[model samples]
Target: MTVSLPTISPEQQHALQAVLDEFGKTLPGCSLTVASDSNVLFDGRSGKFDALEEETDSPRAASKEDVLWFASTTKLITSVAYLQLVDQGTLTLDSDLSEYYPPLREATRRVFRGTDDQGQPIWEDSHTAVTLRMMLNQTSGFGMEFLEGVQGWKSYSGKGTGFVNSCKVDNLIHTPIVEQPGVQFQYGNSAEWLGLILPHIVNQSTEDYMQQHIFQPLGMRKTTFYPFGPEFKSRLMPLRFYDNEKREWQVLDQQMPGLTLPRSREEIEYPVAGGGIYSTSTDYTKLLQELLKLFRTSPNAYPKGALLSRESVQSLFQGSLPESAKGLLAHVMNMRPPQPGDAAATGEWDWSTGMVVWTPADGRRLGKDTAAKEGGWGRRASSVGWFGAAGTMYFIDPESNLTFVCTTQMLPGDHPSVSTMRNALEKQVYVSLQA
Candidate 1:
């Protein structure tokens, strides 16, 4: 099988640069890498690191080496690691997770049905068994802590909110399931459970296991669940918040709540599998490129060995949602912040093993709906991508044989500015491909 590598021409590079320059004016700093399966097409950055910009006397230029908190982007990596267990025949996606982990069975898996008339909690025992597929694919009924119902459950149950970002098992046990397992897509602490159970399955700490299996094999040397060490403190990109009223980027006084780096060995627990990795663009790209290669190749012709088997890699892009959950999944994806100057709903969204998979809406496939066809951030149908809470976005388009990673350190992950920047960059990637 011959796969011709696509190159980004000078004119296309110029157009991509223009996107960074245009949006960079509002963001504190951002870096973007566009690459083919085997080569980098465009690698560019705009703005300055807040740490350097603060030094008014002599501002140090922001380098491409800067590390950014990947937030939910960490899920893809963790998902791959868990799938590796399946590849080794140690775990099965459809097996009841409770049967494998007694803790899950010990904890009551009740569905929160809201308060009774007297303001008392109403709960229903869920007979539906939770599976690894449900957990990784966002259908485990675990609602994110920030969601209104989940927060209400926390208050009613007298559970502390700090566990939301603490990377503890309490994140899953203490949190209530909003729906029955395998019924709907409720994005929350489900991935955190992967972090909790993965160590037990592999007989080592998640950090050690990932370091041995994923980080080292993929050459992600700078990526880690623990990024607060003295070694990383200097290279870490500071978190920033955009002040809409002030029209300027402000360095956040504190990092996102519940995020703490361990100073001593004993203090380390399971790393936050949902969103606790810090990585540079180059380091993260290696993983994407490797996955892209496996994605495009047949099972018999997988190029270099990867963390996941070719079958597992295929699962990453294939829709895993049941018929019952498709509507909810589409609604959730469509709820993203509106891109500037663009007024079309994102068509037909699905969750694969890890990330969001954009597909053609019913009408789009028949060419009856023009808007649905244009709504996938300019990436073709079946493109897979997801966003990080800290203003980071990436997508891999096998149809175009291109992948893109853009990172910025900003709060309120769904801020319009961040989406606008990402949307523009994504659209430009396709434009470059066509040219």
Candidate 2:
């Protein structure tokens, strides 16, 4: 297929480079790549991936070729896999999810009211059927790994607050319906559940499933959910974070992730559907290009070699949060974009299948005002697609036909500096496109 790549004027290219330079000054390690419908407009890597080397007056420069931890950005990729199952007739999006995994069906019958005399969660049967659609939209009643240490979830996990590892449950977090499904949006566990189900239904681990279908088909040789294979360099941009109190950056010494290709692959206890992919901007961009073609092309004439069918692709962009879910989202006021100024542009977001869909306010423009069709930019007007975490972000702008993938390895996922750099970088992309 011939792709007419968008050409950035020389002035726009220089401006983009300056924007990257500004971020390099603030962030110790950062890399960014932006693409239009057909080609990469700007791909910049700067600063040092090794925070410790800074103290010794030497640092490994972040390179454009580096494959970083994808974190939650993997969600969008996994979302495509789920819809592929729908296209293959292996699973219906609306089918009772439990029809494939009997355990999920059994889980739906019970509700976690409180603890029993044995301190285990007491369950009462409920009639709610867990559906694939609900799981895709994050309405599944599942908790995330972060909830492991939270007091409330720990108590719910039946392990005391000091619990270090997963208790009796299969995954780190408990898997009962903490909240009623389809009533509102709950992330984290829904993707995990889907990740768990796919392997069971297909009798192949999701890592294998994705490689055979999404990765191999799309020519994404480096993208995977587990350890880097022997063909690939073992080096990954090490995870690091700024220690506010110590006023220094530190590398995170975390356990090697679960899904390794060979000897290390056995270490993977489970695939985290929500956040476990390891990839480069190049490999991931291929996936985004497929989605971009689906977004811009006619439904009847769907782009050839697209990951999902026309119906599934259309459904993906459609927001899943109902009006009733708005109030629940309101309580999440603690959420903020990476940069302080970006909260306005980025905060007016809604949950979609596996991405956050951005919208504008009524009377005022949200942060970065982009074009919309038919009317004022309301929730239904313009949209954004992404899932970000641990200093990694993949944002797709349907309006401008732009996609941004920024990767940095860091801990305490919500670090203001990490996001500050990301938000600034994103704002610059939109501004440059307006040129």
Local accuracy by lDDT, each model: 0.75, 0.64
Q: Which residues of candidate 2, in runs, are more than 4 Å off?
A: 1-6, 26-29, 114-124, 144-169, 172-174, 253-264, 330-334, 338-348, 361-365, 368-381
Give the Å error, residue 185, model 2: 1.0
Instruction: Give per-residue CA lDDT, model 1, range 4-104, as digits (tens).
Output: 68888999999998999787655755888988778989998886678326537655556776778888899999888889889989988886777656766
lDDT of 2 by residue, 1-435 (tens): 233455567798788778767766546447777887678787777777666677565667777656666766777877888888888898887788777777786556665655667766656666577778878877665543344323344566644232212111254333456556676665545776677778877889889999998899888877877655655564566666667788777655443222111224454566666677778877787787778768778756776656788888877777777665555453442276432433443335567766766555543333433453333222223455554555777766665576777766666656777666766677666556656
lDDT of 2 at 164: 18
lDDT of 2: 0.64
lDDT of 2 at 90: 81
